[model samples]
Each structure stands twice: as structure tokens, then as C-alpha cells.
Target: MGVVNVTPDSFSDGGRWFEPEAAVEHGLRLLAEGADLLDVGGESTRPGAHRVSPDEERRRVLPVVADLVAAGAVVSVDTTRAAVAAEAVEAGAHVVNDVSGGLADPEMYRTVARTGAVYVAMHWRGPSDVMDGLARYDDVVAQVRDELAARVAEALGAGVAPEQLVLDPGLGFAKQGADNWPLLAHLDALTGLGRPVLVGASRKRFLGHLLADRDGVPAPPEGRDRATAAVSALAAAAGAWCVRVHDVPGSADAVRVAAAWRAARDVTTHGETSGAHHA
Candidate 1:
């Protein structure tokens, strides 16, 4: 998956694609660079970011979603608003990537259920502005897995089919820098919940901090692409279903390497089993 932030403050390439035409062009570029799908979001969910009005979000997202889908690109609307998700689906979006799970909008699950579009429910504690305060977790991995499970249950109760659901471990949303590492390390716990896991660790602060300078200054977002690509390779090897990223080419290549490596490992394991049987 490729990211298309149609907001003016997404912490990454914000205003770069804020215009519909630019966003559509970027989406095409990402597709050409091997993005399986595009995740188009209007609101800036970065830490301390303010919320945009529902009308404003719709205005920002709908046209981009419509144009991209019309251009034969598979699109997911990265929104917490039910109205926006419904409209984007109406505009031909294939998925609803809700960072807030179902907490932000009461009607989101129903809208997804009604539309029959794929729903990606990310584990989130609160809104972006106050979420940093809610990052306390006794066991981050266990808590995240359990919380995601609860959200999955809620989505199921709201009429979303189990098979249409995907899970994301909302990296950096309410997490401290250290919190993200364990989640990435224990992705099997999330995938163990019987849903495909979508990992969105692209150019996030945690990666920047990990690759910080000797003076301890974090890397800028654009500078974090290599780290993001590394995470993409690791996550793909660890059974991730998809990795959302801003730089599609690097991650696209990384995942292909991981897939080939996995194939070789599987083949080797099968050969060993056959040798043991013949012996």
C-alpha cells in the first residue's frame, strides 16, 4: 500500500499532494512504482494535530478518491468519518483504513458493512491531539493485541463480515518511540487474531529516532525512507499482509526480496523433510 496524504500537516509530505490533481498524479506514480493500493487521507493524524471539519475532510478527500479510482487505481480512504468512508466507497474506493478503529465515528462499522468494502481497523487509544497522554501500557504488545481484538469484535457485531476485516497496529499514533518496536517484533500476535495484519511503519518518528544522528537529532521524514524500507522487508518476512508506505519503490523492492527469501526457506524446509523421510 502507498500513502497519499491530502492534508496540509501530515508530518510527512503534507501539502505536496494537498491538491486533487497532484494527489491523483502521485497516486499514479505510486501505482507505477508497484503500490498494490493507495491509502488517501485528508486529516493530519500527526501528534498534536487539530481536527478538520467533516465537510472540509470530505471536500479534501472525495475528489482525489474519485479521480484515482476512476483511473483504475485501487484506493482506500484513510478516514475515521463514516460519511467520508461511505462517500469514498460510493466513489469506488475498495477499502476504509480507519486509524481510530470505530472509536471516532459511531457509524463507521455500519457504513463499511453496508458498503461491503474492506475495513482496516487500527488499534487506537484516542484522538491524535490527546493520544500521547494515553500511551501508558503495562504490556504494549498484549494490550495492543487485546485492544485490536475488541475492536474486531465490535466491528463484527456491527455487521462487518469477518473476512472483510484487516488489522493494523497503529504505530506512532499513541505510542512512545519504544512502544512501536515491540509491536513490530510481535506482529505474529496481531496476525494470530485470524485477520490479515497491515503494518504502516513508513517514515514514522520511531524510525527517525532509531536512525538519529550522533548528536541525537532525529532524521527528517524524507530521510527515514531507507529505515521504512528496512521495516517493510522485516515486516513482510514476519507475515505482514501489507505495508503502507510513502516511498513505494524501495519498500516494493524490499518486500519482493522478502518474498523470494521466504520462498527459498520454504523450499529448503520441504527438501529437508523429504530427505528425512527417504532416510
Candidate 2:
């Protein structure tokens, strides 16, 4: 997956693609660069970011989605609003990647079910504005596991098919630097929810913080490609179905390497005849 932020204030590559034409061009470029799916978001969901109204979000995202769909791109709308999700689905978005996991809007689940689009329920506690302070947790892994499980139930209750849903751990949302690492360490727990897991840690603040020096200077988002690819390899090795990333070519290569390594390991440790353990 590749990320296309259509907001002027996204934490990374914000104003760069705020215009519909620019966003469409960027989406096409990513597709050419080996992105299996293009994720377009109208609003910025970074910590302390303000919300965009449904109408504004629609205006920011739909035109780009329409163009991408017309050009044969598999598009996913990154939104937390029901109205925006409905509109994007109608305009040819195949998936709804809601960062808020239906917590921000009561109508999100119903609207997703009505559209029958693949729904990605991400772990989130509240709006982005004050989420930094909400990062407190005694056991980050257990809390995230329990919260995502409940979201799966909520999505099912809203009439979405079990196979049509995907789970995301929301890498940086409401998670402190310390909490984020432990969550990544236990990604299989989220995958154990019986649905595919999507990991989106590319160009995020937490990854940059982890790679910082003793001077506490953070690596710029653009310069974090190597670190992002390292975690991309980790996520794929852990059986993540998809990884949302900005550097599509690098991530695609990492996943391929990880897949090959797992294949080779299975053949050696599980024996060639043990199909049960090959996955």
C-alpha cells in the first residue's frame, strides 16, 4: 500500500498533494512505483491535528479517488466520517481505512456495511487533538488486543462480513514512543483476531524518535526510509497481510525478501511435507 495525503496539514507530505490534480498525479506515480493499493486521506490525523468537516473532506478526496478509479487503481479512502466514506465508496473506493475505528462517528459502521467496501478498523481512543495525553496504559499489548477485538465485534454487529474487515493497530495514534515499540513487538496478537492485519508505521514520528541520536535530534521523515523498510520487513515476517507505507518500492522489496526468508525457514524447520506449518 502507498499513502496519498490530500490534506494541507498532514504530518508528512501534506501540502504537497492537497490539490486534487496533484493528488491524482501522486497516486498514479505510486502505482507505477509498485504500490498494490493507494490509500488517499483528506484530513490530517496526526497528533493535535484538527478535524475537517465531512463536506470538506469529500471535496478533498472524491475527485482524486474518481480519477484513480477511472485509471484502474485500487483505491482506499482514509477517513473517519460516514458521509465521506459513503461518497468515496460510491465514487469507486474499494476500501474504507478509518483511523478512528468507528469511535469518532456513530454512523461509520452502518455506512460501511451499506457500501459493502472492505473496512479497516484501526485502534484509536479519541480525536487527534488531545490523543497524546491518552497514551497511558499499564499493558499496551493487552489493551490494544482487547480494544481491537471489541471493534471487530462492533463491525460485525453493524453487518459487515467477517472477511470484509481488516484490523490496524494505529501505530502512532494515542501511543507514546515507549508504547509504540511494544505494540509492534506483538503485532501477531492483532492478526490473531482472525482478520488480516494492516501495519502503517511508515514515516511516523515514533520510528524517527527510535532512530534519533543522543542529541535527541529526530530524523526527518524523508530520511527515515531505511528504518521504515526495516520495520516493513519485520511486519511481513510476522505475517502482516499488508503494510501501509509511503515508499512503495522499498517496502515492496522488503516484503518480498521477508516472504522468501520465511519460505526458506519453513522448508528447513518444518520439513517440506509439513504443509500445516508452511504459512
Candidate 3:
């Protein structure tokens, strides 16, 4: 997956693709860079970021999503509002990538179900402006796992088919640096939810902080693609269903390699099993 922020306040590429034409072009470019799916977000979910209204979010995302889908890209609308999601899907988005799961909107699940689009429910507590205080947990990984499971149940209760749902750990949402680390370390637990796991750790502040501590300082945003790709590769190896990233080509390449290695491992294990049985 590749991220295309169509908002003026996105943490990584804010204001870079806010214009409809420019955002559409960028989504096409990411598709060319081998993004299997394009995620278009109209709102900036960066910590302390102000919320964009559903009307504005729809206005920003619908046109871009329409263009991407028309051009044959699998488009996911990154939104929390049910109203925005319904409009985006009508405009051509095939997936609903809600960072707030369904907590932010009472009707989000029903909206997704009505659209029949794939729904990505990210672990979240509240709006980014106040999410930091919601990170209180004895075991962040387990807590996230449990919360995501409940979300799955909620979606089902809201009439969403089990096959149409995916889970995201929401790496930076309401999570402190320490919280983010443990979640990644136990990403398999999230995957064990019996749903596809989508992890977004690209250019996140916690990663920059981690690098700063390790190297005595950290590089700027431009220098974080490599780190993001590294994390992408790790997520792929851990069996992530998809990794939301900005560096599409690098992360796609990493996923391909990880997939090949996993295939090889499976083949070898099967061979060993056959040989042992014969012996």
C-alpha cells in the first residue's frame, strides 16, 4: 500500500498533495511505483492535529479517489467519519481505511457494510488531539490485540461480513514510543485476530525518536524512507497482510523479497516433513 495525504496538515507530506489534480497525479505516481493499493487521506491524523470536517474531507478525497479507481488502482479512503466514507466509496474508493476504527463514528461500520468495501479497522482511542492520554495500558500489545478483537466483533454485529474486514494496530495512535515498540514486537498477536493486519509506521515520530536514541541523533524526514522500508520488511516477515507506507517502490520490493523467502521456508519445511515420514 502507498499513502497519499490529500490534507494540508498531514504529518509527513502535508500540503504537498492537497490540490485535487496534484493529489490524483501523486496517486498515479505511487501506483507506477508498484503500490498494490493507494490510501488517500483527507484528514491529518498527526498528533495534536486539528480535525477536518466531513464535508471538507469528502471534498478533498472523493475526486482523487475517483481518478485513482478510474485509472485501475485499488483505492482506500483513509477516513474516520461515516459520512465521508460513504461519499468516498460512492466516488470510487474500494476500501475504507478508518484510523479510528469505528469509534469516531457510530455509523462507520454500517456505512462500510452498505458500500460493500473492504474495511480496515485501526486500533484507536480518540482524536489525535487528545489520543496521547488514552495510551494508558499495562500491556500495550495485549490491550491492542483485545481491543482490535472487539472491533471485529462490533463490525460483525453491524452487519459487516467477516471476509471484508482487516485489522490495523495504529502504531502511533495514542501510543507512546515504548508502546509502539512492543506492538511491533508482537505484531503477530494482531495478525492472530484472524484478519489481515495493516501496519502504518512510515515516517512516524516514534521511529525518528528511536533512531535518534540509537545513533546519538536522528536524520530528517527525507532520511527516514530507509528506516520505513526496514520496518516494512520486518512487518512483511512477520506476516503482515499489508504495510501502509509512503516509499512505495522500496517497501514493495521488500515485501516481494520477504514473500519469496517465506515461500522457500514453507517448501523446505514441507520437504523435511515428507523426508521424515519416509524415513
Candidate 4:
């Protein structure tokens, strides 16, 4: 999955694609660069970022989505508003990547069900502005699993097919630097819930902190792609169904390498175990 932030304030690559034409171009470029899925988000969900009205979000993404889909790209609209989602689906988005996990809007689930588009139910505690305050978890991984389980249940009850949903732990949404690492390290915990997991750890602040400079200053967003690609490789190896990223080609290569390594390891381990049993 490749990220296309069509907002002016997303933590990274904000103003770069704020224009619909530019966003569509970027989405097409990502597809050419090996992105299997293009995720276009109109709202900025970065910490302390203000909200965009539903109409504004629609204005930002609908045209881009239509243009991309018309260009033969598989597009997912990253939105929390039911209205925006409905329009996006009508405009040719194949998936609705709701970072809100059905929390922000009472109408989202029904809207999603009616559209029958793929639903990405991400783990979210609150709006971006206040989410940082809601990150108190006894065991971050376990809590994320339990909370995500509940969201899954809700989505099922709302008429979304069990298979139509994908779960995302929401790498940096409300998590601190410390919290992000544990979640990534324990990604299988989320994958164990009988659902495909989508890990979006691209160019996030946590990676910057992880790659701190000599003076302890975090690297800028663009500088975090290498670490992000590393995370993508690890997550894919851990069984993530898809990893959202800004630099699609690098992550695309990383996942391929990870898949190949896992296949080889499994073959070797199986052969060794068979030899040991025969001996």
C-alpha cells in the first residue's frame, strides 16, 4: 500500500499532494513504482492536527480517487466521515481506510455496508487532537488486540462481511515512541485474531526517534524511509497482509525480500526437522 496524503497538514508529504491533480499523479507514480494499493487520505490525522469538514475532505479526495481509478489504479480512501466515504466509493475508491475504526461517526458502518467496499478498521482511541492523551494501555499489544477485537465485532454486527474487513494497529496514531516499537515487535498478536493485518508504519515520527542523531534529534520524515522500509520488511515477515508506505518501491522490494527469506527459512527448518526425526 502506498500513501497519498491530500491534505495540507499531514505530518509528512502534506502540501506536496494537496492538489487533486498532483495527488492523482502521485498515486499513478506510486503504482508504477510498485504499489499494489494506493491509500489517499484527505484529512490530516497527525497529532494535534485540526479536522477537515466532510465536504472539504470530499473535495480533496473524490476527484483524485476517480482519476486514479480511471487510470486503473486500485485506490482506498482514508476517511472517517460516512458521507465522504460514500462519495469516495461512488467515485471509484475500492476500499475505505477508516482510521477512526467506527468511533467518530455513527453512520460510517452502515455507509460502508451499503457500499460493500473493503473496510480497514484501524485501532484508534480518539481524534488526533486528543488521541495522545488516550494512549494509556496496561499492555499495549494486548490492549490493542482486545480493542481491535471489539471493533471487529462491531463491524460484523453492522453488516460488513468478516472477510471484507482488514485490521490495522494504527502504528503511530496515539502511540508514543516507546509504544510504537512494542506494537511492531508484537504484530503477530494482531494477526492472530483470524484477520489480515495492515501495518502503516511509513515515515512516522516514531521511526525518526528510533533513528535519532548524535545529539538525539529525530530525523525528519523524508529521512525516515529507510527505517520505515526496514519496519515494512519485518512486518511483512511477521505476516502483515499489507504495509502502507510513502516510498513504495523500497517497501515493495523489502516485502519481496522478506517473503523470499521466510520461504527459504521454512524450507530449511522443515528439512532439518525431517532429518533429525529420521536420525
Candidate 4 residue spans exceeding 4 A from truth? 269-279
Q: Give per-residue CA lDDT, model 3, range 1-279, as digits (tens).
A: 899999887778758999999998998999899999999998888899998777888888888899889999999999999988988888888899999899989999999889899999999999999999998999898999999999999999999999999999998899987889888888889888899999899988787876675656755665678888888888898999999998788888888888998888777876798999999
| Candidate 1 residue-wise lDDT at 237 | 98
Q: What's the candidate order when arranged by decreasing TM-score?
A: 1, 4, 2, 3
Better of 3 and 4 by TM-score: 4
Candidate 1 collision pairs: none
Q: Candidate 4 lDDT, tens digit per residue, 1-279?
A: 999989988788758989888898888899999999899998899899889887888888888999999999899999999999999899898999999999989899989889999999999999999989987877999999999999999988989888889999998888887898899899889989999999999988888988889999999999999888999999999999999999988899999999999998877876798999999
Candidate 4, after superposition: displacement of residue 228 in Å? 0.4
Estimate the TM-score for candidate 1.
0.97
Superposition error at 90 for model 4 (Å) = 0.9
Root-mean-square deviation per candidate? 1.7, 3.2, 2.3, 1.6
- Summarize candidate 1's per-residue lDDT along 155-192 as a digit string, tens digits: 99999999999999999989999999999999999999
What's model 2's TM-score? Answer: 0.95
lDDT of each: 0.95, 0.91, 0.89, 0.91
Find the 10 residues in a row with the least total lDDT in model 2: 269-278
